[model samples]
Target: MASSRGGGSQQVIRTGDMEKMSLDQLKAVKEQADIEVNLLQDSLNNIRAATGRLENASAALHDLSLRPQGKKMLVPLTASLYVPGTLDDADKVLVDVGTGYFVEKTMAEGKDYCERKINLLKSNFDQLIEVASKKKTLADEAGLILQAKLKQSSPSS
Candidate 1:
């Protein structure tokens, strides 16, 4: 009896009798499967490397979050003088310790640093995305090759 495969090809193998594939057909199938396996491995490796980079960036962010926000330093004023009128000498010696000002400056610097780091992380993420896209293309090509090989090897219908 004649049987038809899905791709408009006909084969004359009997319905009840199963025939073994030729050595070349078996080798072709094996090769197609190997290509699929290799493509999958490469995709996995790309994903792993991307994940590692993201993890490292996350760790750096965590470290930045844990950093001290700067402490104010106490400055003593020493002056031997007296204001005989209204304000006392101690009151007149109310000096700006400048700690608050310096803290604000330092915080600004830290913010700039964090921004730069975030930009770098974003760039790395973009690179990872590009890598993933390339891997996906490779995987798709491998899948198509396997499908075509399988279709070619199948009994025609």
Candidate 2:
């Protein structure tokens, strides 16, 4: 496999020749593999969090649709701050579509938006999981190779 390096240089390491590599080279490969694995895991975690938030929004939409119009409730203005208000139009709701943008949509449409976003995020999460699994396997193999090289270079007890 060819490992990409800075300055557009690539280091190619054949699987059959791992034992022939120097200790420093093996260590570098192991470190790079570990870093890639960590980054992939972080991406997977972010996708999971986004999916959870969308699911919660969908549930809140369902609950809101059940309430009658003109019902008095506490409307949140900021964290730990809410003002007493009455529901003016429950059927029409504002949806935050991200990047400081909000769009008005019917309650049913808002719920559908949330569901679609959840499905998209879930699909991305599944694809990322497969990539992460392969990276983890590569990292494990590099670690084992590095250990073997270290033992060969060290003095025996």
Candidate 3:
């Protein structure tokens, strides 16, 4: 077996000719690799869950935006001002309960939910970034240790 050297340099290692590594060195390398892999997996899972919530929130917002807002009402109430095309079909008119209210309550609720989802996604992203940084540091350290071991095992040229 063969492996490339650190920093994408020209050096290479031929494992077959290398002397056997000590038990402690092997165990240390294994532990470092395991930590990096576990952190990466956790980051992946967090991003996946955050993305799902974002997609759901975005879909709800889109659906709300497409709702029809111009339709005449069959039953006219004196207190409410009926705005034509408020409902999806011709049967329902948009009714304003006295005070020039243009707010879509459902849409408002959806926006709130979307905001919350976005905050959660941002938090997850930050966590993933932190984890990724730690993984990189550990991986770099492991690579250095492994390279040192390989050099020690190699015949002095």
Give the number of the best model, judged by lDDT. 2
lDDT of 2 by residue, 1-157 (tens): 1121121354544555666767787777778777877777788888888888899889988988888999998877765999999998899989999998999999989999999999988887787777667667766777888887778879999
What are the clash counts of all predictions, listed in order?
A: 4, 0, 8
RMSD of each: 20.6, 4.5, 14.8
- Model 2 CA deviation exceeding 4 Å by range: 1-14
Candidate 1 lDDT, tens digit per residue, 41-97? 555555456556545544544544454434232332324543333221221122122
Q: What count of clashes does model 3 give?
A: 8
Model 2 TM-score on a 0 to 1 scale:
0.85
- Judged by whole-model lDDT over C-alpha atoms, candidate 2 comes out at 0.78
> In candidate 3, what are the lDDT values of residues 1-157, reduced to their tens digit?
0121112342322333222546475556547556655656666676677667667656745654665556343333443753433455422223222377643445556566556766776675666566556545655555666678778779999
The lDDT ranking, best first, is 2, 3, 1
The lDDT per prediction is: 0.43, 0.78, 0.53
- Which of the two, 1 or 2, has more lDDT? 2
Indicate whether candidate 2 or candidate 3 has the larger lDDT: 2
Worst 10-residue stretch by lDDT in candidate 3? 1-10
Cα deviation at 136, candidate 2, in Å, is: 0.9
